[model samples]
Target: MKIAIAGAGALGSRFGFMLQQAGNDVTLIDGWKDHVEAIRRNGLNVTINDKTFNVKIPTKYPSEVTADMKMDLIIVFTKSMQLDDMLQNIQAIITDQTSILCLLNGIGHEDIIEKYASKQNIFLGNTMWTASLVGPGHTQSFGDGSISLQNLVDGHASEAKYLAACLSEAGLNAEYTDNIHYSIYRKACVNGTMNGLCTLLDADMAAVGATRMAHKIVTTIVNEFAAVAKHENIDLDTNEIIEHVESCYDPKTIGHHYPSMHQDLIKNHRYTEIDYINGAISRKGQKYGIATPYCDFLTELIHCKEDIVLKNDPVIN
Candidate 1:
């Protein structure tokens, strides 16, 4: 299989290295000049379970990409805010047979992807996998994660099965699902609580979980997300989602980690995906006449943080 990782950031680097090790022809496409140059000069550095090594793989910037570079699959891991621009820049490599699998976090991504690729060639999915960008061309990942995906259009079961098998071969724990929308919503509920609250409080998952008010905050956010999901005809088990999210608070698990949103706003001084996560829910809630005050407030607060961080930065300003 010839694959291209469109974002090639933290998670994208992890997937690209694994796929390349599985004997697939994988090339990383990213916009980060320093990261791309580092990988091209030296191999990508990957640390898993305390052991670190480098893997050599091809990488290119979106502008440097040409039509001659054909791809069997393009896995999109770009930030939610960068999805549209990435798709627009990569149009030349998408052929009739090329399939696009979006593992991006958040909701409503397919609508943007379908503009460039056919619905039949698009796949929607989510993962519990986590990765950190230690530095340029370097990433650290641990623990186990599973992928659940489905075809965006009906009657593409064979294609979905093939892609799942390929990823599973690379130790990615992939599975095909008939209800990926439900899976996406379930994951969004998890992100809505951990990502939003952790960013607002400037705390790690365990810190947020340890607070006396943790349960109340989680319950309130979960209820709002559940209401919006139901209005959209996506059934979500509120209690189950809450339990799963709370389990991440264990110090042994992802409790020590700051989510991507926190990393974006605080560390990188960049924008966040709040608009696609909680903000998307708030928008839909308005359409369905369901009020989502918690989601609405969280969205506004993240944007405020972005304003403060970006405006204060000399380079960004």
Candidate 2:
């Protein structure tokens, strides 16, 4: 398959490298100049379970991509805020037959993606995979993650199945489902708690889990998310979601990891996906006359942190 990994950051690089290693034709599209240059010049450096290696894969800036360079599939991993811009820049590569699998973290991405591609050609899912961008061309990935996806529009299950099979063949642990919305919401709950709280407290997942208030904080956030999910008609088991999130708190899992939001706002001084995760929930709660005080507070706190970081960093506008 001719595949392109848009956003080629941490998770993107991991997927691209794995697929490439599996003998698939894969290319990475990213906006970061240094990262792209490093990958092109020195290959992609990946560290998995303390083992390091380089994988040479083709990469391009979105602007450098042309219509002739069409892809059979485009796996989107861009940050939620960058979704629309990435789609706009990569327009030339999307065709009627091209399918887009958006495995981005957060909600409301399919809405933006549909503007550039046919609804029938879009796929939605969430991954348990975790990766960290250690530097321009280096990424640290560990733990096995599974991907759950579904067709965005009816009558396209075959395409989704094909893509899922391909990813699974490449060791991505992918599965297709009819109810990907539930999975998306479930993952959002995980992010809404871990991502936001970790950033606010400046701690990793395990540290937050170790805190005395861990259960209270996690339960409150999950409850708010469940209420909103119920309003959306997605059946979310509050207990199941909480259990899944708590499992992630184990140091054997992703406990030692700082979530993407923490890496974005605190480390890189970039804006977070709070608006898409917790902020999305808060907005939906308002629409349905549901109260989401916890989500609302987390959203505000993350934005306030962004403001503080940006204010001190003269380099970032």
Clashing pairs in 2: none
Regions of candidate 2 where Cα sits further than 4 Å from its true position = none
lDDT of 1 by residue, 1-317 (tens): 99999999889999999999999999999999989999999999999866898999999999988999989999999999899999899999999999999999899999999999999999999999988788899988767789999999999989999899999999999999999999999999888988888888999899999999999888988898889989778888999999999998988877887888887777777789999999999999999999999899989999988887798788677
TM-score of each: 0.98, 0.98
Give the best candidate by lDDT.
Answer: 2
lDDT of 1: 0.91
State the C-alpha lDDT per candidate.
0.91, 0.92
Instruction: Count steric clashes of candidate 2.
Output: 0
